[model samples]
Target: MPEVWERGADDEFAGRADDGSYDATARVVDARGVDDEQRVEAALRPKRLADFPGQPRVRDQLSLVLEAARRRDAVPDHILLSGPPGLGKTTLAMIVAAELERPIRVTSGPAIQHAGDLAAILSSLAEGEVLFLDEIHRMARPAEEMLYLAMEDFRVDVIVGKGPGATAIPLELPPFTVVGATTRAGLLPAPLRDRFGFTGHLDFYSSDDLAAILVRSARLLGVEALDDGIAEIAGRSRGTPRIANRLLRRVRDWSQVHGRGVVDLEAAHEALALFDVDVRGLDRLDRGVLELLCTRFGGGPVGLSTLAVAVGEEPDTVETVAEPYLVREGFMVRTPRGRAATALAWQHLGLTAPMDAPGAGAPQLPLDGEGRFS
Candidate 1:
């Protein structure tokens, strides 16, 4: 949760830069078209629950919950959505409001820095409004306490004065739903976690699901795309809809400039190669980690700090941004000792595993006579 405050029209709020102004959202600021190439991700976001693909379990469960609440003509219960970034937690929050036909107030946990800030937002809520709190785990401790009381009792106590003269004033709140999203749900206290009536965890999308998402997004963006092209992009999307959509736009650029103005297999491959994303969906940093582990450290039991230093990245960035996916994809493994690259990782990087490597007996992908993975 970063404290990026920029005001927008009415209830809308945008993130700001250090100088207190809206900064253009881009992957890089270089003049090499990276800035323009970074599409506005929100444009492809699904507005309704049905339009959102993947996470079948969560979607089905959430649909029933919302329908039941609608039938009762009441506000839905508080919900906690837990998952990694770009998996559509925020989209689901908005869908909750859409399904209930209620207006939603958008704010993040970092915005509520004090008990008073939480009080103001809670107290000002209209009955049945949906309040979305992104990155809920990063909320201030004092605010967390106030939130517990508010959620359970629909009331908050305002403390006035100082020292022994402190007086508590009770304020009643209208019944409303708090839709909280967090990437690190384990960090939430048990007391706060128990307050949510329903909890949903989002998981990464499958390649088939990603393909379907890309097709739908192509229609929304009015880009002509072939099925093979969609599949290619989906295969390299790292199982995230956000990345899939972003790659689609870049592919569209290559199609228009280098070839026919349609996203075909050739356009997809050319655009992806230009971006340096490998066939297994591993980007430069991802391959860098694997390469260093296999080559520099002899298939490593290397420490995370040493590995991060070798890659010129912060330990936290490597842990949160890269390690989870690598571990999930079976390219890397974490042990009590340290980090180690799997035999699959070595093969993926087009290198042979050393005889002494950990998990040297791991199964290898079937290969052609020319040494290409089949």
Candidate 2:
């Protein structure tokens, strides 16, 4: 479970700090910390384009841009990678760093809440460094505005002091490249999106691509995966490389515990079953979230807040983490009113959809892969 912090929940939000505690900014910076688990994940992250798997379209397009930029000995154009989490946005960011032959300075939108915070980071970047800003749409508007000018002109106007004496300090930044990543592209302002020279949407991987990923992971972890086992995992990976890798990791644990030398069908099935991840790619959390919305919420015209309470998940996790897969899998719909479980969702859960299920007076949104959606 993620820790709960009260940064925005008190009088500390008031600048006076009458409680005898430090200011928010100081506490904020001091509180930002990561642990060994995250460190291991980062170290294990694929560092180059070739090392990264899935999203063939993005990989091919990015390769062309990289080759062209490499020839000119210049910084590559600003790029935006929009996709679901754990689908290799960060991996792609690292790949951009490696391909451009430059260092990467990683940060998140909420991490730099103020313009000065962004200014300090941006001005300090070396030329050609890849500044990967993840969840960029969540950035504060003021900093985002500053980002526009910095991106367009490689400069920023640092404002100092109060109304009468305020002055815009002109600061030049290095011609570094910005690799903005977001799971929700709709939330990004047009001006911000338009500044990027290239935008890549990382779609879900095909089963074949996921199979290749399993092969790669097998090699990396020194496990011999049977062909059938790989195929099974691939089909049940939620069409995401991250899930594929995670399933592989879990299977590895199974092999070790059971004294198996290779990851065969039995080992794979046992491991996946233990994790409650079904062959159709539905995890317990995914199923529970859908079940609650469909049954408990009555095919939902239910508000997200109410649904989140029913399912015990962060709303963002439902929206970004789980729903994309559910939505893509023809399991749900996001309507103007609220989220609704589709006919396919009912079928998957071994139940029947409501009378209004798709085309039967069901309200359908303009979503991708709509045919099987209901």
* TM-scores of all candidate predictions against the true structure: 0.86, 0.80
- Per-residue C-alpha lDDT of model 2 across residues 147-166, encoded as one tens digit per residue: 99999999999888989999
For candidate 1, give the lDDT of residue 56. Answer: 90
lDDT winner: 1
Instruction: Report the poorest 10 consecutive residues by lDDT, candidate 2.
Output: 24-33
User: Candidate 1 overall Cα lDDT vs. reference?
Assistant: 0.88
Clashes of 1: 0
Q: Against the true structure, candidate 2 has what lDDT?
A: 0.83
| Model 1 misplaced regions, further than 4 Å | 1-40, 363-374
Error of 2 at 54 (Å): 2.8
TM-score of 1: 0.86
How do the residues 285-358 of candidate 1 rate in per-residue lDDT, one tens digit apiece? 89899999988988889999999999999999999888998998878999887999987788788898877666
Residue 289 deviation, candidate 1, in Å? Answer: 0.9
Spell out the clash pairs found in candidate 2: none
Clashes of each: 0, 0
Stretches off by above 4 angstroms in model 2 are 1-44, 293-306, 312-317, 334-339, 352-356, 359-374
